[model samples]
Target: MLKLDAYPQGFEEDDRLRSAFTRNLTLHFSDRPAPPSVDGAIRSAGVPKTLIRYWHDPHDVPDDVRACLASWDRLHNEGFEFRTFNDASATAYIAERYGAQQLKAFARCRHPAMRSDYLRLCFVLAEGGFYVDADDVLLGDGWRTIFLNGTLKLQPLCYDIFSSGMVPAAEIWRHDLPTEGRIFYVNNDPIAAPAGHPVLRRALGRATEKLLGNDPRPEIQATTGPGNLTAALVAHARDLAFAGAPFDFELLHDWDAIAETRWDLTYRGDARNWRNMDALGI
Candidate 1:
C-alpha cells in the first residue's frame, strides 16, 4: 500500500504538489505491466495498470527530458522500490490539533520536497532500499543499463565543480575539502551500487550517524552533507584507480561529464558509444 504522511496545510502549495504527483504518478505507472520475471509474480504485478499514466504522453515532456524520464521510471518500477520516513510525531500533533485522522493512519501530504523533507526523504528511501529519483521517468525495456555496465550512474549535481556523474565509495573519501570544512557528496538522485555492497554499507553508516541522529557536528551541518558524501564516494573510487584496481576510470570520468552536461533528458549526442548501444538495440 502507498503510505503517505501528514504535514501542515498550505492550501495553495499542498494542492499544487498533490496535483503534480498525481499527474506524474499517473503518467509514470499508467498501462505498465510487470516484467517477465519473478517480480511479475509478486505483489508489484498487482499494482493498478492505470495508477499513473500521464507519463505515457510524450507531449507533456520536451524532447530532451523524454528519454531520461522514461529510463528512470522503468528502473524505478522494475528493480527499485521507493519510500520515505518522516516526522510521524509532528504529524501526530497536527492530527490531534485539527481533529483529523489518527496519527497512525496514512494521509497524502504534499510531495516531501515542498515540506522541507526532500533530502531526508530521499535518504530514508535509499536507506530503506530505492535508487531512483522521485520524478525520473524510465526509458527502455529493462534495468540492465544501471547494472551490467561497469560504470555507476547518477544525475550529477551541477551545483558542485568537483562532482562525478556517479560517485562510488571509492571516490567519496578523497574529496579535498577545506581544512576547516567538511565535504559531502550527494547521490540522492539516482545512484547505482551493487545491492548489499560494502561501499553502500559504509555510506549508509555515515549517513545514519550524521543525518539521522543527534550527532550533528558543526562541520557536518555547514557542508553539503549527502552530496558531499557522494562526492567522497567518487573520491574513494579514484583511490581504487590509483591502486591499479580493475575499474574503468575513463568511463567513470566520462559519465561524470555526461551528468554535468544534464544528460538526464539531454542525450549525449550521436558520437558517443551510447549511439553504438542504441544501434545494437540496447
Candidate 2:
C-alpha cells in the first residue's frame, strides 16, 4: 500500500503528493493491530522480542564493528532475536514487505547511514520491535528494561551551538536547556516501539516526502536522521495536548552508560562515515 504520486508538472503540488503518501500509510497501518491503549493513554507492552541492526556490507564487517555486533549477539541467550540487513537485502525486504512505493523511496537515500535510518522506521513501524545502530555496544543487562515496555524509547541529546559541542547527558534534563544556544533533538538510534506508534508514523511520512519530493536535496539530518524524528515527536505532543490526550513515549536517561557509540573505529575518518561524506564532498 506504500505510495506517492507523480507531480513533475508543478512543484506546488508537492503537498498533494504528501497527502497521497500519508493516505497510503493509513491504509497499511489500519490493518495492523493498534498499540495498546488504556483510558486515553498508550501503555507500552506487547512489543515483539526482535533486535535489528544494519550495515552497508554484511559480507565484510570490520574487526571493531564485529566486537560491537557481538555485544548484541550475546543477548540471544536472553530471549531476544537478533536480525540484520545489508544495503541490498534491506531494499529487497522493504520491497517485499511494503510494496513498490516504499522501495522507491528507499532507493532515494544517498548513503548507507540514511538507508539505515529509514529502514529502522519501516521495520519498527510494521513489526514492532527494537532497532539499534551497529556502532552502539550494549554494556549490560540493563537493556532488558528498555524492552520491557512497548513505548518508543529514544535517547535525548542537546547540542550547544555556541560552544560547538554537546551538552553533558546529565545536564540535558534541565528545564532551561532550550535557550538560544541550545538545540534539542532525540537520537534515532535505539528505537524501541510497539507497532502503529503515531510518532513513528509521522516521522516516516515526513522523511518519505522529503526524500521523494522535497525541494533541494534535503540535508541528511533534517531529512532522515534525528531532526526528522524530533520534529515528529514535538508535533505529535502538541497534537495530543491540544486534544487533551496523553503523550506516550520515554526519553532514555543514562544511555551513555547502558550503550555507547564507539567513535574510534576505522570508518570514523573515512567516507564510510556520513560526516566525512558531508565534509569531503563525497
Candidate 3:
C-alpha cells in the first residue's frame, strides 16, 4: 500500500511516467480477451508457429549466446519453427518484404541493437509470429498458452527509481504503489502477435520516421527500444478506449519463469549491449 502525493526527487522529475502509468492501469483492468489456461492454446489463429531471433553477425556468435540459443530448441520441439537472421539476411528480408522505405530505415540504424529493435516490428507486422532476443533462453515448455489469440503479447515492466531496480510484477498493479518513484512501461522483446497488428505498425512507423530524420544517430531506447514500444502501446490503448473497443494487446506476466535473457553473455560487457551505447552517449 505504498502511495505518494507527488513525483519524488530522483524519479527523473517528469510527468510522462504518471500519465503513462494511468493509461497502463486501464488496460490491466479492462475486460479484454485473454488466453484460456485450462484447455491450452488454439493453434488455428493466424499467428504462425514460428520463433524469430537475430544477431548482427552470424559467424561470430559467442559461446554464451550459443548455449542460450540451444535452449530455444525445446520450443521447437513444441512445434515452433525457428529462424535466425544476421545483418545481411535481415536487410534482404526487409527489402524484399517491406520495400524501399523500410530498407532505408534499416540502413539508418547505427547499431546492432537498434537494427534488432526495428526489425522485430517489421517481421511481426508483416508475418505473424514470435520474436525473441538472441540471448534469451526458453525455461519451460508451456509456451503454447501464448498462442491462444492474435493479441500482441508484451511484457509489462515497472522500475523503481528510489530502489534503482525493477518493481515486482505482482505488485505493479496495486492502486496504492508509490507513484513518485515508480515508472511503468513495457518491453519490446519476446513480441508475440498476429500479422498486421496496429501496435506493431505504429512502433515500426515511429522507428522508421526517427531513423530517417536528420539525426545521424538516433537515441537507441527512445527511437526503437522499450521507450518507443511503450509510447505506441499507450497511444493504442488510448485510441481503443476512446473508440469503446477492447484492447488489441495483452500484458505478459511471469514470462521470466518461462524464458529469460542470459545477462552474463560476453557481449554485454562490450559495445554490443545497448546499455553500453547509452553510457557512452553514442
Evaluate all candidate structures by whole-model CA lDDT and list the values in order: 0.33, 0.73, 0.77
Tens digits of lDDT, candidate 3, 151-221:
88888777888899998766765656666766777889889998999988988988888888999868887
- The runs of at least 3 residues in candidate 3 whose Cα sits more than 4 Å from the true structure, single-residue gaps closed, are 1-23, 26-35, 38-44, 278-282
Write the residue-wise lDDT of candidate 1 on 129-207 in tens digits: 3244324445433333223333433332222225422334333323342212222223444454433343444444443
Pick by lDDT: which candidate is best?
3
Candidate 1 stretches with Cα past 4 Å from truth are 1-130, 139-144, 160-186, 212-225, 248-282
RMSD of 1: 18.2
List of clashing residue pairs for candidate 3: none
Model 3: how far residue 100 lies from native, Å: 2.0
Report how far off residue 202 is in candidate 3 (Å).
0.7
* Candidate number with the higher TM-score (2 or 3): 3
By the lDDT metric, which is better: model 2 or model 3? Answer: 3
Q: Give the Cα error of residue 187 in candidate 3, in Å.
A: 0.2
Query: Residue by residue across 224-251, what tens digits does model 2's lDDT show?
Result: 8987887676566545545667547777
